[model samples]
Target chain A: MNVVEVTNICKTYPAFFLNRVSFSLEGGKITGFIGRNGAGKTTTIKSMLNLVHTDSGEIAYFGMPLIGHETEIKQRIGYSTGTISWYPRKTIHEIVDVTKTFYTHWDEEAYRRYMTLFNLDESKKPIELSEGMKVKFNLLLALSHGAEVLILDEPTSGLDPFSRDELLELFTTLKEHGVTILFSTHITSDLERCADNIIYISHGEIRAACSKDEFMENYGQPGDTLEEIFLRQEREERK
Target chain B: MNALLKKEMRLSAMLLTYLFIGFGLMALLPGYPILCGVFFITLGIYQSFQNAREANDILYSTLLPVAKRDVVKGKYQFVILIELCGFTVMAMMTILRMTILADSPVYRQNVLMNANPFFLGMVLLIFGLFNVIFLGGFFKTAYSIGKPFLIYIFAAFLTIGLAETLHHIPGLSALNAFGFDHIVLQISLFLCGILIYAALTWLSYRKACTDFDKIDL
Candidate 1:
């Protein structure tokens, strides 16, 4: 079953437009969403989450439309925006204390575990944390809520290599536990390591959507890395 | 919606939002227009919105387990909550002015806007204007504050000037009635203000929700 199905979603900006984007993520699979900057990766994800209203089309989660089932659907989905400039004066503990009230499935023990694992101080505010730490804190909140599907945008950016590897392992473990992920980033190496599917977008349009082996076969040569494939695809599109 | 409101109280509200209710006591001050008291109240709310925008409060709230429309609803709820709270304090002061101090020489001699139901009604009207003008206008772009706030400031001060100047006009002196001189009419004016407040605030909320839903951010 498809964990998420985005059908022909379109969003237009004065300078840029997300045109007729469509894709589906299979249940319990890690789908890597790859794009260069200004490629509408964020816009498409935001539209799917209904954070940005689409001009036309539908986004569904678990076979239910997002419009009527927004609160219910969002409850089961974990979205961590790379930016965490919200309530910068509030401490992490305070933010979490308030956030946990919205979800009936909040797991306090898991929250505590992620907090420790991320080495975050409860008293620290978002303003005081490093960008990478902010991302981890957001991921912690996403993970703590028992979300079945994680929609993460650049969740690994600003992390050290060791931390990034640790996160990749965590994603692998979460997948084994039946958690589906749509990981959006320009980091092709991360996708090369663990992604089962690829959804490559460029110029505000989806360029490819397929399983990993199929994507590599169609776009890559023998021993070619995911980065090489991405570069080649982008060059061809521009030409 | 309740959960979103609690989040606003805990996360987005500024410290001055609570403390500025004291400004309502300006209702009792002689020689100054009581209408300006609630203006101070709106100023506190204005500052909070400014700060919230800087911190991207709307983005954070939208990401939570709530609908995007609910984010706008929660903000309106918070604003109305603060407006009513400050109004309560002002009401107390207005009551005091209408009772024991009704016959006081200082109040009787004051040329400024008197503490009466008409005055209270004017304050409510100004607040309603703020809702539709400032708050609703902010949702148009969902990020810019200067334009909406400027429009609100113009509207609020114009309301204040009208309220202060109305009693001075020929044959309109009864609007300045004190010590229950025109209690029934004064109460009716106050009630009308309440109705307009309710209607305009409701209208603003609907418009804001619609505007916010169209925004990409």
Candidate 2:
């Protein structure tokens, strides 16, 4: 069964518009939401989460609608944002304790493991931590929730090479456990390394979506990287 | 709700401490312990307003599974909690001042003026008015990106007008009809204010939740 199904979603603003966007994520797989800035990736994710109201469309988590079933859907879906701003005075432990109260399936062991792996200081205030550490803390929170689906937006934006590699390994492990993962990022390399499927969005529309190997085979040239393919697709769309 | 309340209390603890100090200072100035009460009450209202702003944890909070209504209710609960703590400190200071300056001739007159039923009523009225203004202003500001100060000013005027008119009505004037000698009356008025605040808080929560549902995020 599809873990998430988004159909014909549309949202319009003065300068930007998302037109009839559609996508789905199945169990035990990873899907990459690939798009440049202003391509409506975040908007689509927000709509799926019911954080952004769509003008038209249907979104389902499992089989229930996202609107009235938000709390239930969110319980099973761990989410992380690109910019993780937290309460300045709260320490990581305090945040973890608070989050634990909300999720019934919270995995304390997983939380402890992530803390050890990331070298996160539980006693330090969120404001006192570095940007990468903040992201790591957020990732830990999202992962330790024991969620069936993980919706991460730009999870590798500011990480160093080592941290990024560590995160990729973590994702591999999560996938091995049969957890569905949907993440949006501008870093095509991360998608190439970890993503099983790609949903390429351009100008608020889905340009192409298929397995990574199939996408590479169809559009990728000899010595052509994913970045080259993305740029080429974007350039072609503009023309 | 617990998380939101803890976060708000931690951030507003300093403001609450300052309010206590202000009440203590007000009590020493003379016969009018009621003036001290009024001063502390207004300060408490202002603190609630400030706390509301400081509790804007939208980015992280929106990710949580809780409904938006619960988030708004948590904020109102925080404001009420702060107000109650401030009121308690102010009441203690008032009693202490009353005892200390009981025999002072100069303060005797001041005390009478401060303790007048009308004066106390007006203070309560103003506080209720401020609560409405603060909630409305915060909601208006959250909906748009324009000048919130102007929206606050407008909300203040609207709240003042509505509260004053409501208090002037025959039946609803019970809010201002507290008799200092009658403990029951005082308790009833206090309860009435709390009930009104609770109702408005629920309404505000509903408004916020519906607005969030309609918002583009």
Candidate 3:
């Protein structure tokens, strides 16, 4: 069963439009939503979550339309963006307290574990945290709610190599527990490491959707990586 | 909806605290009840818009597990909660003044002003206008707080000035002179204020929710 299915989603802006974007993520799998900046990855993600109103199309989560089932679907799915800005004056404890009230399956123990694991001080205000800490705090919020599907935008954009590796490890652990993850990131290395499926978006339209192994089999030699295939595809599209 | 309201309240704690302090200070001044009404109307408009901007509230709220409509509803609920708090505090101070400070100069000055239903109704109408214009203008451009705030400031001053003038006109002056002593007039004025407030509350919410639904964020 697919966890999420987006079909024919379109949104028009003065500078760009997400034209007929469509894709599906299988249940219990990690899918890397890959694209360059201004390539409509974020727009597609926003439309899927109903954060951005689309001109036309449908988005389904767990086999139901997203419009009417937003609250239910959101309760099951966790979303984290690159810049997670809330009330800066609020303490971590206050933020967590407020956020946990929204979910029925919120795991208090899980919240505590992640807070401890990240060395997050509950008493500290959000503004006192570093950019990396802020991302981790967002991740902690996403994970603590017992969310079945995690949708992240640019999750690894500002982290160091060690933290990036840690995040990938966390993704692997989440996949083991049958939690589906759809993360968009510019860093191809992270996707290559754990993504079972890949969806490439370019210029507000989907260019490719296939398993990483299948992509490698078709476009790569024995040693050519995901980056090379992406570069090749970019070059071909420009022709 | 409760979850969103809870979060919004926490986000607005600082503003609420400031409003409380302002109310407390007003309690000591002559004609404090009239000041209370103006203070809440101005502060409600100013703080709601200011807090939303400073907190980057739209982005934060949209990311939450809430429907767009619920977010709008939660905001209205927050404003109503603040107004309730303001009214309660002002009423309590009024009662205390009447009972304990009957001979006090400040109490004597404000006693005839806000004690009447007509004055209360006028205050309600002014507050209603503020809500209608501010919330209606806000959801049109979710991020543009300045335009709405400026518009409300201009509207509020014009309204209070007009109301003051109308209160002194010979025909309306009879009603003001009768004041709270005339039970029938008081009840009628109170009912009128309440009806206007309720109608504007409904209109503002409907308009804000409609405007918010169309926002792309």
Best by DockQ: 1
lDDT of 1 by residue, B1-217 (tens): 5888888888888898888878999998998888888989999998888888877889888888888888999999999999999889888988999999999999999999899898888888989999999999999988888898899999999889988898999988989999899889899999999999999999999999989988877
Q: By DockQ thresholds, what CAPRI class is model 2?
A: acceptable
Q: Candidate 3: how large is its RMSD?
A: 2.6
DockQ of 2: 0.40
Instruction: List candidate 3 stretches off by more than 4 Å.
Output: B15-18, B21-28, B31-37, B93-115
lDDT of each: 0.90, 0.68, 0.77
At residue A224, candidate 2 shows an lDDT of 82
Q: Give stretches of model 2 more than 4 Å off.
A: B1-4, B10-56, B91-107, B111-113, B116-123, B141-206
Top candidate by lDDT: 1
DockQ value for model 1: 0.76
A-chain TM-score, model 3: 0.96
Fnat of model 1, as a fraction: 0.84
Candidate 1 residue lDDT tens string, A1-239: 89899999988889999889999999999999999999999898888788788989899999999999999998999998676556788999989999999899999999998998889999999999988888888899899999999999999998889889988999999999999999998989999898999999999888899998999999999999999999999898889
From the highest TM-score down, the ranking of the candidates is 1, 3, 2
- Per-residue lDDT tens digits of candidate 3, residues B40-118? 5456546655766676777777777888888888877876666656555555654555456656664444433444456
Clashing pairs in 1: none
- Taking the tens digit of each residue's C-alpha lDDT, what string does model 2 give over A57-137? 999988888888988888899887657556656677766776677778889998888899999889987789777777788
